[model samples]
Target: MRRIPVRSLAVLATVGTLVLTGCGTETGDPADSTPAVAGADRTIRAHEVMQLTKVHEETGMTLLEGPTFDGTGKLLVVDVTAPAGKPKVIRVDVRKRTSQAVHTDARGAYTSAQFSPYDGRLYLTDYAHGEVVSLAPDGSDPRTFFSGDVDGARMNPDDIAFDEEGNLYVSDSRGLSTGDAHGRVVRIERDGKESTVLAEGLASTNGVSFDADYEGLWISELTQNRISYLRLDGKGGVASKHTAVRVDGGIAQTDSIAVDAAGNIYQALHGRAAMVVYDRHGERLATIEVPARAKGLESATNVAITPGGTRAYMTVSGPAGGFLYTFDALAKGVRQSNGG
Candidate 1:
């Protein structure tokens, strides 16, 4: 595997911070007025309207991913510590702006967590173990819900989402490099059986989300810097697939995605230090930069919207540490079928 030089990583991290802070140029608030994107209708300067604050900090919890919320409005996040250290799942009280570790298991690298509406339990992707696990909402009673290979290939689950019928859709991002499109989307039926829905043309599928109307599924390609949407057949299969949006210029590496009731897409643009908002037609709406306090962070990895869609929470990871940041969202989020 190729390694990123330490010096280059530092430079990238610094650039990311500067981009979010709007430090170098006097371009006069790109977020304030409408962005010059061809079809953009409105631009929301989120940093101005939404307050960014650090809610919690921990010394060893440095690789945080996934920020999901439950029906009651409690935010759940996962720390991706592995091998040498056990990963932890934490629950946060957004109202109180406080957090508590709910579960700490040494089994495998847990990267993402999703609440199952049908069972009212939290489902997590165990990347190292190549399977999915379930736990009580508070992170108790960890059990192997789905494991082993899917379609004869080792499962490297990265992120997860569910359809209206309670079936699970998982993004199996097999490797980190972009030379090969090894990523695949797997569907786990309500009965726990697994099948491959999409097995090609994806490089590092990082995030998966269903449209509010349950008509389309969005998958983020980390290394490819693109978002693909699949029209569902309403029978647990893809009717068609196509690219919804792509990040050009210097910005690449799209991460987890969140959608609102109005079908607007909120995608974390890792390395760019901003969250790019898109309308239902896949047109760029706005870019909400990360605050300057994330000075040494290389990227914002994941984003979660509140039930009411009034707020958004994102996780940033880099040399400085893992931090959770939030801001006001443009519209109310479509309440997840399964709590969050």
Candidate 2:
């Protein structure tokens, strides 16, 4: 097979250097002016949960993103750049710090893995194929559960979230390369038949998750370097939205995020080895640095906090390869933390 260039998020590298002058007019409730990680809890030296073997060809870099836990207490992650014939999904034995291949397909560059609360099947975003597919519990029966044009155009589906009633919300991460660039959010009903545009005109929508109370959704915009809260109406469309918190990301870009039971957001950062914590109202709490000092561990793209929110498992990768690091959670983990 011919080589297909990887790095579905290659835009991150070019746009990461863009200075975060501001996050629009929503700076009234600003993050603290203190150092990003000042006086923050430096997690204990992390135990290497596992390492990925597959490496992409073009950049010679490997990445592990979309870390979420299965209902049976195992952590599931995606190999964002895994090429054809290689495992695209992995299951981690956090207790033993070992990993096993769960699924592989030649048609997709899987960016996110989320389980539907109503169906119990693992749903993943195929970044390359522009489709949201589902898998059986044992990694069988891969099928295109949702696909086709979103908002009159194709989408580069990035992160995913499932609501209490089994609705799927997706972030389309393409079209952010120019001044007119915008990201989109699409919602699919529980039956996977009807899809509606939830929100649009975003700046590189990356991480997406529901709030603790299910009142709204939290979206991480990479180019703008901020997180936005999409307040949902009774019909699940976006009611009102506001920038929750502006990330003081000097040279880094924001990625996926998880919301705890306390309504705090744990946002992952690309090009930096840290996760920033913020309250529901956009108050900056702390920035937790990556627990390891390895050369390539400086970038953590996604985090999965256990059900209790007592622990967090982050997916880290650079030239040194893909690694998983664990840290303590600032708030109790809730259903929103995992698989979303």
Candidate 3:
């Protein structure tokens, strides 16, 4: 391993400063703002605040996203190569802190990935190939799980998740593309079946997760600076959505989301250098800050959790490539509700 250049470090250092200062657009009046733990109903109260403890190297040429724990608690993450290389998914042994590439394909620029609880295998979304790939647990033998032709649409997939019954849900964001540029959320069943759209005309649907109870889908609209909830009829296939949290005029560009068993929502505030959390009803709970300056927290792009939600994992963008961060999920008090 070689040292990262000082110039790049300077950029990241600046982002860390901005993160501590004030990130996100400020909106609304004092009435809607409350200390997540203060005014939160007992139902939504966060019992613990976990702090991120660095688990592995955050410096490298690999851009990591879509992190999740396998049944054994090992962390599996997708590595999107820089402009010059192919995409690969790697598995990191949390206990050992060692990582190895499991699979790579040049035809697609993989964005986000997830491990299917349905079969304990890995599923990935590729913007370049316009489809999702299912990789064996060993990271070999990739297969197409679903594609746009069946859904009547095509866009870059930013993230993905599955329901209790093994139905696949995905967020399709039209990244930097022309013509409306709205994003979509789609559902595909385990047997390779497609359903009607969950929601459409979105502004940058990046990170997504199902509610802890598995009844609704929680989605993050990055450019819109807010999170939404969709009540799903996973059985009947009807999708009704609603706004969960509205962050007024805050900064946009959210990259990933994680949910604890308590129904608290966590977001990797990309371009903000902050990991934000919210109550189930959409109240801003806490904003956990990290050190990343240039490109705002190095675009703290993805987040994952250890089994039982005891720990959380995140990756940050680097001027040269990227770095990874791990933290205790429920540690200390959540960041001052209003930056006090």
Off by over 4 Å in 3: 1-62, 82-87, 179-181, 234-236, 248-252, 292-297, 331-340
- The lDDT, on a scale of 0 to 1, for candidate 3 is 0.57
Steric overlap count per candidate: 2, 2, 25
- Candidates by lDDT, descending order: 2, 1, 3
**Where does the lowest 10-residue lDDT sum fall in candidate 1?**
17-26
Give the best candidate by lDDT.
Answer: 2
Across 212-305, the per-residue lDDT of candidate 3 in tens digits comes to 7778878877667778888877574546877787764255355667777677777766554557777777766666544222232345666665
- Residue 120 lDDT (model 1): 75
TM-score of each: 0.81, 0.86, 0.74
Which ranking of candidates, highest TM-score first?
Answer: 2, 1, 3
**Model 1, which residues run further than 4 Å from truth?**
1-61, 82-87, 249-251, 336-340
lDDT of 2: 0.74
Q: What overall lDDT goes with each candidate model?
A: 0.64, 0.74, 0.57
